[model samples]
Target: MNSRTKSINELILTAKRDGRSVKYVSDGYHTFDELYYHRMILFSVICHANKDRAWKSWLHDDGTIFNDTFIVGIQTDEGQYTYHYKTEYWDMFQVQEVPRAPKYDGHKPKDITRLLTL
Candidate 1:
């Protein structure tokens, strides 16, 4: 399939629907949704390398709290918004630096581990 034709949301949804294991990368983006007066927002879909679980992070510019996930990191104009999936639940944070991923175990594919580190 031509990945170039799909949006981040589409790619993630497709992967989930097909039961295919794949990761994603994007050069920061914004999407418009009518739910909040067509506000533009940023998000990321995190795929765990060795598990069937995935986490989604929604970066809220207005600091609106979404009760669904636990909050972490710093919420400020200068902080980076991050989301982490832990023990069956998702957590959100605004960080100065992206959280370090789990260390490589030498079992999963290199492509998956390459983007993750201790």
Candidate 2:
């Protein structure tokens, strides 16, 4: 197994033990202190990709395997936002592009569509 796969596996195990839902934030807008949330997001993203193979070959040839860290934040009832961590530098992290779900040419069949159709 490769480093990325190993890391992902370890993360998956951690998430299973903690019992938290995973989310993916490509914008790198989260803080490091929210390690649990971050790990959860990463796991979700990887699992969505369906590349859960244990070998390194599962990753893309470019060597990039979903680059973004997870962070925690809370939205206030008054419409304000708060981060879990305080820092002087916020621009250091760059936003990443998440994979888009395959689009259907027209209305999708109910059996295959995971999303609800209007």
Candidate 3:
């Protein structure tokens, strides 16, 4: 099948209909299981990868698809906006738990401004 023909929403819906796993990746991404186990919010889909951007799935109650990549406030009814699914739609973004820095064990040495001191 031509993966490039499908959009992110199409891919997701197809997976849902066929009971298949949706393929996704990120700059620092783990498997779906890892995301689930780590407790993350699977929300909206976008074409761009912005570190500070977080999108939540917003579908129309009347079954309408809107291709808006630059959504204000990341509201609902925002379906897949990217044109190519093969290359662009694969990177899935979500809000996951970032690893915390190692706690300081009363070590009065080195730079205190450093976030991680292990």
TM-score of each: 0.22, 0.20, 0.23
Q: Taking the tens digit of each residue's C-alpha lDDT, what string does model 3 give over 73-101?
A: 12113221211112232234442212321
Please list the C-alpha lDDT of all candidates, in the order they appear. 0.33, 0.33, 0.33
Q: Model 3, poorest ten-residue lDDT window?
A: 78-87
Flag regions of model 1 displaced more than 4 Å: 1-3, 7-12, 24-70, 77-82, 87-118
Model 2, 1-118: lDDT tens digits are 9998798778867876898544441226654446645654543344334322111111232443333422222112222111211222222222232242122233223332222111
**Model 2 bad stretches (over 4 Å):** 25-118
Candidate 2 whole-model C-alpha lDDT, 0 to 1:
0.33
Backbone clashes per model, in order?
Answer: 2, 3, 4
Worst 10 residues of 1 by lDDT: 36-45
